[model samples]
Target: MTATIDRAHAAARRGPVARAYRFELVKLVSQWRIRLLALACWIAPALFVAAVSRQSTLPVDTLFGRWMHATGWAGSLVMLGFAGTWALPLLMSLVAGDVFAAEDRLGTWRHLLVAVRSPRRIFAAKTLASLTVILLLVAGLAVSSAAGGILAVGNQPLVGLDGHLLAAPDAAGRVLLAWVCVLAPTLALAGIGLLGSVALVRSPMGLLLPVLLALALQLAQMLPLPVAVRLALPGYTFIAWTGLFTSPAQPGPLLIGIAVSVVWAATATALAYLLFLRRDFTNPAHDGPGRRAVTLGVLPLAALVAATVAVVAAAGATGPGIEQDKVQRSVATAFSHLYRLQTAQLNRPDVTEAQLAATAACNKGGGRLDARGPGNDWRCVVTWHLPGIEAAGTAVYQLDITPDGRFMADGDGPKEVNGYFLVRTPTGDAPNPLWQFDGNVALLPAAPKG
Candidate 1:
């Protein structure tokens, strides 16, 4: 009978509860913590950009994909990764943590609770307000990062991982898409911070703890952690999937990374809700047996995951060469579409013995007929026949590889011919998909062709 009366009274206080929740926004913004958080979020990216500009380790030329990423949209994505990893999450935590703790710190939480009459409703309102702020901060960071990256670097052609360069227009579109991908990872961390804030009521360090945790998880990801465990870490979607900018794009890893970020965020949020519901308001919030157990539960899980990864790595390293076999299998499977070599050279009724031998050798060598220096296995080849003078001419072109792969036969034969070749990797005998080459390459005023 008494419990029913108390429940009815609590239900009747809905108007004051709603007002207290709205006031949380005004209270959170006025704090110096909010100012510091905003600065941290903005400055972290700016510092990274400065570091990139001043750093000497990154070369300006084609040292693999380094120069290309530093040059355009790729550069901006790099800055966003570092910023998004901890900066955005930490900023949200700063406000969210204070939302609960600030009331306790002011010693006004008790008074507000009596006015609101419902603890659960107040908690919900506080959480929603903080989450809204987190979303805005992240959006601001994204816009600023894009603007800075385009201005500092320029929207130039992105040299893809496959070593092909992309023009500025294409690069711009990718930058926008990549920035949006970061939101999932950020949201997960923000959820974690909110949970910590709710559980630990008044500690300023509660906000800082999630930031430290985010950093730790990132470091773990770089180590020999299992793929399953690595996926749980925030911001991994940025790297595992972002590498498609490399040549021969692979989306498998990226898809998996996004899946992992989504799952991690969802699970963390569920655990948070459980903690909030079970907590005792009248007990005055000590890190007591209840909170201690929740914290300790994470320990065995971390160790078990860590040990499993270490054992798997050690076992794989000790065993017979499975990794090598996997690579060989993947390469062979990737090239399975390549076909047998056939040639119809010039007006000659039959190809000369030399031409036939060259084609045979090239086929056996996986399409690279480079009889000189180191060899390559790309199988797109082009051969041409024309009457030629004493200049170098195309004896063979492998159209099966990207970034154009082939060898030219220097013509001492005076066949008076010019042959051009266009290659795309491992595609079977089509007459020509399309060929992009100009024999003259460049031209000037009235140079007579004899």
Candidate 2:
């Protein structure tokens, strides 16, 4: 059709301003994929919250506590870092990959341009459609994840990075804010995928290439690149999100992360539009050797894979080198060695799940102290009280784990010989150890939950 040819010719000519809007609208349907992705997103966080909420090990409740336990209660933090850092970028890729590239996949670009009557308008539509849906899908996933988390875990007090527990209101607010901050970095990821889509119109690999590129970037971050490299990654948003855990929570990294992602996204999208316009689909030579030399050409795949291996190796090699430290050692395989049941302790009247529930009412007010001893030994000062003990002075106890698996306690002001572990007993009673004290060495052993 004369009309169809004209439209194709126009998408090539649309100025930068128009292309932005064009890309955004065409993929409003990304929401369908989002709806599906939502199922997995919602279910995963909820299940984590539920599993954590039901656990008897953590001294209290929290999202990170659940995350920590999932990290095998602090013992597996290094392993978690190695594996999960890639997750955000991978997720962002699913949506970004389909944006501009999907038009090519469906063979709609030429047809739609004809219908639009203006190349500029088509570009605007596509860009707008892509960005809008990407933002919404991410927002929806965040909200759903938070909602499921709140409902599953209950808005209980949250423990902080310093092991300081926060009241419910602040805890709830922080979690939601952290989820929102994630949006900026995620958009950066979407931007990368969008650029790939726009550039690779003729190939099915367009959908997959952006993801491969992101992984490559993640890998490069680990190599001995200049300092600038660390500051520039679009997906570095995930790392910046770590602010949610730091004391006084720094926004500097998060804001910088947004700036980098946005700038790169804008630049990449502009380049894609220029390149796509210069080539005519009808021209066989466009995909020929000359254009081939412009990119890593056929080698983005090899580059991406090599980067993957490098990063995995780099992260493993560069950790804090604390493997031999006692804090890094497992006291007993957690949960595997269940605390030897004391039927006498269980039969005691106050030690019931109901009494343990009383702990929920225990007003959480405590100061933090970081203390260390002779054996690669670090002490976490928990100034806490067992509920039901009002006259009891605030005790700053030294939570010491020896160079081996042994834990020791030296604290001020308590006739209690050890800290109390409020536990559930199968023999009908769960101790309301709200104020009871126990030795610091008590670690129940069990394999991490599946």
Candidate 3:
């Protein structure tokens, strides 16, 4: 009886933030939608892996799709790309966007703010609760996708974007790291959802706004925007994990992407908090955003646009573009490593990358003299010395380069020379290491003019 009384006193002494947080968590736990979303997060990826595993034709369009049947690691990566573009933002919005809007819909905002008598505490509690759910969902998706991939296809060595093969253990580590990297951008989207939740009182509007914005941002990213402009947006970071799989992992863009994402999340969440404070909770008839909502929203959005414009203007002077030399160097190095792997698979005498001495001359826009910048028109001719052969072997490649510093190299060489889409190896017919590859080009300042 004494111990029970002491526990009661302890619960009574809990601070308002803690109490509110507990309340929000309990409410979320009681919701069927939240429960269903959590279940989907865990089960959907597994089902996706199973479905992909049964396909006779691989999704060659996706970065890791060609290897989906060869290794479970590739299956996880293929899912990662798909989730980034579609599932993740929608999932985040469904929860964070509804957290506040639900209270409005249920007419509980007056009680939460007036009866509780602390809007700030309530806001803090709701934000914390929503973020907890979001983080858990993301982590669940990552773990489920990885586990499902391993179960469906087996954890074989993964092929890196830079054409080097990663051991199963190393690939596992990189896959985890890649998932971790995506969390920043995902949180940024959550912040956008939170803003929508507070600013748009209607549940449907709050839930759909962030998803719509994400779609728009993705479309904008695909355009030939300035490098700075593209990098400033959080959407670009969704695919930034590609750099982690490169031969010399390009941490430059990863760090920048994380920093950019943090800034976006901070600013957007702050604006959401400010708007939440200004909301007139006593008015039950407030169906749409009021004058203050429009004012507060416009100010932050305008500032963001101004900052982006300033960055774009500053970057314009440098004439930033994907360098031909960098592309040539990166693709050539990656090709040598892949070639060595292909030879090893065929039981040929082991050859070293140094021995091959590969070199590539790449041109953009169909042999234009000034062959620089990101585009799908880039072409490269690679020449390499083969062991015991007098003439250097040659391969032609076409590159589709994205503005955010990734490129897909498709071998245009004769199938007999470059090998077909699938190559016969001791293990079976695995993906040809030469038919297609991926690589990164670091966005560095161009060389100073002589």
- Top candidate (lDDT): 3
Q: What tens digits encode model 3's per-residue C-alpha lDDT throughout 197-259?
A: 888888486788678878988898777676676666777678778888987787755766787
Could you tell me the C-alpha RMSD of candidate 3 in Å? 4.1
Tell me the lDDT of model 2 at 371.
Answer: 24
Clashing pairs for model 3 are none
Measured with C-alpha atoms, the lDDT of residue 130 in candidate 2 is 61
Q: Rate the local accuracy (lDDT) of all candidates.
A: 0.48, 0.45, 0.82
The candidates, ranked best first by TM-score, are: 3, 1, 2
Q: Model 3 misses residue 144 by how many Å?
A: 0.6
Weakest 10 consecutive residues of candidate 2 by summed lDDT: 331-340
Q: Write the per-residue lDDT of candidate 1 for residues 1-450, one digit (tens) a residue.
A: 999998998877766656766777666666686766666555555455545644655432211214423464655665565565656556656765456666656666567677766667777677767766776666666665656556666666664433345577766676666666676766666666666665566666666756776777767654543344444345566555344553344454455456556755665555566666666666554442354535733553355445544543443322211122222222222121111111222223333323322121134254234321212232223333323434322333332221111111211221222132222234532221112210100000112469
User: Candidate 2's residue-wise lDDT over 83-201, tens digit each?
Assistant: 23554565656666665555555666666666665555555566676666556555554555455445654545544442334566776566556666666655655655655666665
Q: Which stretches of candidate 1 lie over 4 Å from their true place?
A: 1-21, 39-65, 68-72, 84-86, 202-205, 232-235, 247-249, 283-450
RMSD of 1: 14.2
